[model samples]
Target chain A: MTAYDPARRPRVAVLCSFNVDLVHGPLSEALAARGLPSELYFSGYGQWESDLHNSASELYRFGPQVVVVYPDLRDVVPAFGSTVPSKHEAEAAGAEAASALGQGIETFLSRAPGATVLCTGLTVPPVNALGLLEGNAGYSWRSAANAFNAHIQDLSEGQGRLFFLDIEPVIQRVGWTAWNDSRLWCIGRMRLARDAYPHLAAFWARAIRAMLTPRRKCLVLDLDNTLWGGVVGEDGLDGIQLGHSGAGLAFLEFQRAVKTLPARGVLLAVCSKNNRDDALEVFRAHPSMVLEASDFTAMEIGWDDKATGLRRIADRVGIGLDSLVFWDDSPVERALVRRALPEVLVPEVPEDPALHAEFLHGLEAFDTLTLTREDIRRSAMYREEAQRKTVRAAMAEGPPEAFYRACGIEMTVVRADDFSLPRLSQMVMKTNQFNMSTKRYSTAEIAAFMRAPDIDVHALRVSDRFGDLGIVGMAIVRRDTSPWLLDTFLLSCRALGRTIEHGFLGFLSRRATSAGAGLRALYIPTARNAPVKRFLDELGLEPVPAGGETFHVTIPSGLVAIPSWLTLTIEE
Target chain B: MSDKLLYETVARVLRVPLETIDIDSSPETIARWDSMAQVALMLEVESVFSVRLHSDSLMALNSVRKIRDALVHLGALPEAP
Candidate 1:
């Protein structure tokens, strides 16, 4: 389990339109529970505008990585509690209020010093002029709030690092009355009830944790009651209520949802306590089964306990148990997995079959902020690796170096263009293990850097005989004469340990030397980036200030000796 | 007994000990009773007592006695108090 690190977890500032002293306790408690202890900067009530505009405000002084703005409808919208307005008047007022919100978010972003801002959606008052009729059409309080939320969504859609958390769903779950306590509001002018702090703060905390940790690589699933209605072995393949009708719709929908996981880069695995043949029969011959046998990345079916099966699946996938989520409808199986592998996220599936699809859809644990080409092809890449493993095992050599050399690896290095921008940015965002500087960049930022005359972005592609590992590496260099600075250099974990980074650095060194400036890089040590740090230090890059992070390596203007195994090509 | 609950509630919100909170211990005296903690204490008092404090009483609720007096005036005293 990832332990809470108060100093390292990104700092977040909560700037609200109301007093938030009651919030810090539960918010801290929730964040601590998730292994992300926050160093919070809570602005005083009604100081949001000043916190954003005033350069010397505590918000900027804290230099937080995330700023969660809690804007209540009473303040952000017009006539929130005042006299009800006509439909036209309400619609116009909603537009104006939404624009003001956009402007506020823009102002906060401008002054935030590179912090991502999460503006919570405005809560629509249930008992408005139109009441339930407002949801049907026209401008009621609900429609007006929806309009504001739509505009908020528009702002985030065009830009990176901006998001609008739809607190409406949370409101729907918790109910408006409980979410907003009248007694607390009357006493202290707090936006939400004292107890609602954890629920509200959880939205921001989840987003932040997703940003900090790499996404869970695999999803370990259970068959029988989890995938479909009834046990496969007991019910038999013909009796399974998968795609028949009515109640079977729930099972079919759940199957479809599980099938869709792999497309989003979540590898699937089956861990069932049923007979292997009985389970495979459903995927093989059952016409109603939405998931095919090929959909699963690994399988550990039979009479074994789900706990052992999950470990086997994780081991087979070459990912840690922490990087897996187990879904089992049976509480007994779920309990066993939880006890044996507590690190595995075992979400409680709703008891009612009808709620299964909704329960699966509501899982924010699988939320990934960005997607890349590498992500799209990740499942195929893993499948191809299985083939490579078989070939390696058949060969005389058992070592990786011999296998890599024998595979006839080919490499291509090119400047990041339209074709490579998405993957390059994704590598920057998610690649932590082999990254020299753990800096995340959006596609827009990567495009901006590429357009700059002083910056050069290198996108690398490597392929062995088994398959081409798509754009797997990136090296960004700030090219100024006399001392070119290596801004961010990273390679995916898939292509590490082959002296590929050495070739990447050598390529950069030659490029820098030709431009009359040699290569200079800095290795800021992080918990995950030790591989890059060790590589840079061992490659004889002398530390400029002797034990400092800044390193300089001189490259003679000649053909730098890359590894003999790699058939390298450098595209302009 | 109600006064003890009030003291304990205040202490809980401020993250201090129950014994540390006394009748005369105001924001001026308690280190945790800053502007931020004042808001926490106000809401907690309202929730615990189920009394909606008037704006003046809320602002004036600086010390333990002031809170107790305001709750008593509202007749929203706890079961023990």
Candidate 2:
């Protein structure tokens, strides 16, 4: 996914209006010129209803790693018509339209839960009505377009399935007249002409890539010669050069940068080639050591191969090797780790220690789309995982099931509230490996759903003898007259292989049935969510394709027994 | 400029064979005309010609002709494109 290879095209699904993009010509050409392989699903121009369903199907079939929806002309007709309703009425209409569209999107996403969907927020059309009515139409159109974009943003947040690409800043920078000449917009006579706009295309492509790819979770650091000017073992812990003066200041700035990552949700770990006792003493005793023992989730301080040390750190923290970025001054150690774990990213350390700060900042390999609560608590989670391993090892004398049961695992399912909103939104945004709808949401939008009467959302918290996994799973439901639509269902990657999702859904279905809901229609069959696509099928729920990736199931009112392995309780 | 200097700059930028570059060579003329190579080329040109190119100029300098024109504008080359 690096910008190096042209042939390594990411499968992209373009879901937007099928119209003449007169102004956005350059954008279109730029995408084409890059040789970016894409499947364009045009919602017929001015035909919102048909386009919505068609686009959904296209999204499912294409199963693109990234979904880019251009809302250039989709909202214009509804915005400009004389019969357009007031804000409240328009909101109600938008909600209805969104729900219907969501069903199709849900189906598509269920089939390709790992794909990152990018929705280009509505663009202002170049139709100025100055001659028509003193430019009142232009003003009205801009106002309406603003409202439409807001709704799209809300929908993106609520469904957790869309990334809002706001082109306003880029459009403003280019300006209207300049933008017109720049081929960012189509003007008179040309109508739907498209010109090649490489700059804007590059911006959009970079943004999309940043959103889809996972950033490095853990930074494995070497302390001696790398973090400071000298080896702690040879120079003595107190004698190391690290502080606000000379070569020490450079290390200090690097420490500051590494420390900031944890706040930004990047966990720090240490894998130093030094005696365990000496390294620990240096970390504890050094006055200039801004990064302490507590900063790292795990540390491997020994003369073991750097590759072996990184493996131990990764295993202890319960993360894949690929998710780690190793930093070492020794090229030999770096090369060894690179050979053993080619997936692990090892950026080159500059010869001059003073240039470390600039080198670290210049590395774009660890960039992510958005930071969520999971990121903030990632270090803590890894710490808990390490503790869990020790506890499990102690209890390993008996059968695994006995040890797990003895851990006093208790599950709690509660309707999502402000307290659990961050975690729930995080599960939607970042949980890729075990997600049913690779949907992403914002804190504000998830809060809005909690306030909505028609939507039912639940968050699950699992606690064991070791520690509490605070709000690890979430499910959002939209109630229609006849059936309850499972809008979104996702669990953290750590909670996988536990049958927690199945248990959670069983509990949810029972609750829904008790609430007088008869049918449970799940929009499933995403590429990355196959684990749950046949979930209802295994439950004896007959699945019939309702066009696209949606499935309708009629649930019997009988009390279905949840998996015995799961010990469940409900929280109000 | 001698072929040696041009080849050195091209090889450093492309990280490819010095033998692959010629006076008439362009991004399209080379096998590594990917996004990364484009960026590397821009960086190399900046270093070799000692000239800062604007975003538009960077976009325009895909071909050797365009690069020659840019170098002339930056006074790194003498009246030739």
Candidate 3:
């Protein structure tokens, strides 16, 4: 299936404390705001406890990719009254409440280990107790909430797939008095304010997008008002608003915000309709400029239209337009790019430059929930790809084989373990084009495979002089008898043309021969598996072409040749 | 103004058209105004009028007129609009 297919939008289960009737409407709108779609399933009101414990419950039946457990103050408290209960009674109730909630969370994780769980912390009311003696009481409303939220945070740290969403910060941002409307709570049992739905939706959507959707990899910026307060071509380096002083601090703050993206593997590029030398001067000469020339992965600074510039940046970065996010202060340029390149995300910069930093922070577009080791080094990987391209450009026209040989590509095949299993399974699920047998397995299932005696699972880590692309391929072999069957085999698209698959198959063949069995790899013909289809045939395997999916090479018979460009090493 | 406003709030809470509601509509006649809807309607009316209905009055919210009369007794509704 093509990337960004609507049907593949991550499935999310919103197990809410209140009636999710009104909240569901804004949840969809929040996803639309980020261009991430979700198939949301709402559990019955307050069924989070039952759904978490029962395997046959709706939570398991729906099989959501992400579960958002949102609880309000009303959900935990059976009754609300202005008259405060005695200090002794309050203490008893608080301990009981925390235990029940903690137990429910523990049971849910035991049943659902692979699915991501994002639980919202309880929001403390503006006034916890009646008069002002809440501080004197040991089990005050605030204290109870603090204990419960802290427990959730601890549970999140303990559990492999759990995160505590601190709703208190959001409430404080909009003021608790304004956020907790007395009208909606008393009248409709709608604990969360209707007006606050948009904010809550936007907040939770960032987390859901991060967990389920691929984040924007490349952030394309305009040099004029985007990177600085004024157009660099006209303002010149010293004159541009990018320093510690008034009006200039705003651009400095904006530059500081842009610098954080690269650390998280978001590639930074400059696309502007200005002289390249003029833009370079700011990055070079400006003492206060937080960004530098080396910081940007690519630069397309010229008088060309932004759409064309964005295309060149995308091409240079080796990513598609859909993965690029364009930031420009000019509304006309943003509008033109929006109309021309509909795939690219061009967020509108505030008219006032002072709000630009806050605007970028509010977007929350480029971040995700889980950051793997591969993800942290992704920007460097693309820069390496750019380096490879430069080398290709410098090579006085020859066969591409000489370039591949000189690149010093190496592959290490190792057995799957706890550390590498997550990436291995993720590659199995996300990699589409180069996959021979498009088998998708969860981390839990991969663990099961690792435990099984007859099944062998191996993953490959490839690297070159430029950088390392960690754990980009996975292979699962079922070795019960002679002619061992290839259960699941796939390589990431990034490692495809480099012929890492040859080393992968060669390693599997050696293992099969050592086990005193013949080697057989199967290719279930899929629309995207054409590349694999050709490689499987050329491996010198006996083609049982008449069947649906069969190719076998007996030991001392099947041709197993490792490419000279790649140094293959098998790890214990 | 408060009388008309009270009727509009009840209609909205019950998910019924304003024209379809009056002082006589109760849970027995309105299919959607079940136990949960009754609690919702009473909460909404109490919030709109800035007056809390008694726990006993929760079951007595049988008809729109009864609700109006309770609001009037609580001095929440203006004198007969």
Candidate 2 residue A137 C-alpha distance from true site, Å? 31
The candidate with the higher TM-score, 2 or 3, is: 3
Give residue A105's error in model 2 in angstroms: 15
**CA displacement after TM-score superposition, residue A560 of candidate 2 (Å):** 17
CA lDDT scores, all candidates in order: 0.77, 0.66, 0.76
The DockQ scores of all candidates, in the order shown, are: 0.29, 0.05, 0.12
lDDT of 2 by residue, A1-572 (tens): 22323455566555555332322434455456434443344333444334335645444555567666654433434443444344455445444444555555555556666665666665554644322342243333444455556666776676566667777776665655544332111211122212123445655665664664566788899988877878877988778889999999989888877877788777888998888898889777878888888889988888888888988988877889988999999989888888999989999889788888778765656666566766777777777776767777897787676655666667898988877876677678777655655656787888888899988888989977666777888888888556677777788767765567667877877878878875465555666776665555567767677677666565566634576767899876
Residue lDDT tens for model 1, B1-81: 378788889989888888888888887778888866776788778888777766566567888887887787787765335
Model 1 lDDT per residue over A1-572, tens place: 12224567668888787776667777787777778787888897778867877778888889878878777777777486775666666666767777876786787777664688777887776755566556355547765677778888898877676777877887888777777765556666765766677777776677667665677878778888778888888888877788857778888898888777788888888888888889888888988888887778899998877788888888888889999999888888788888888899999878988788778766877886666556777777887777776777887457676876877888899988987887787788898899876877888999999999988888999888878888889988887645777878889998886678877777777777777777667566678887876775676444445265544444445535577777889997
lDDT of 3 by residue, A1-572 (tens): 11244667777788877765556767888887777767788887667677777889878888776888887765675543544766556545555665677777777767776577888887667665545777664436665566667777877776767888878878888776556656455555556544576778888887776666677888898887777778788877877787787778888898998888877778899988888788888888888889887778899988889899999988877889999989887888899999999999888778887888888767666866556677778778877877877887787498877888878999998989988977887787888888877877888899999999999888899998878878888888988856898877899888877678887787787778777786776566677878876875675444455365644434242366577788988895
Off by over 4 Å in 2: A1-205, A388-460, A463-467, A472-570, B1-81
TM-score per candidate: 0.69, 0.49, 0.74
Cα deviation of A551 in candidate 3 (Å)?
Answer: 3.2
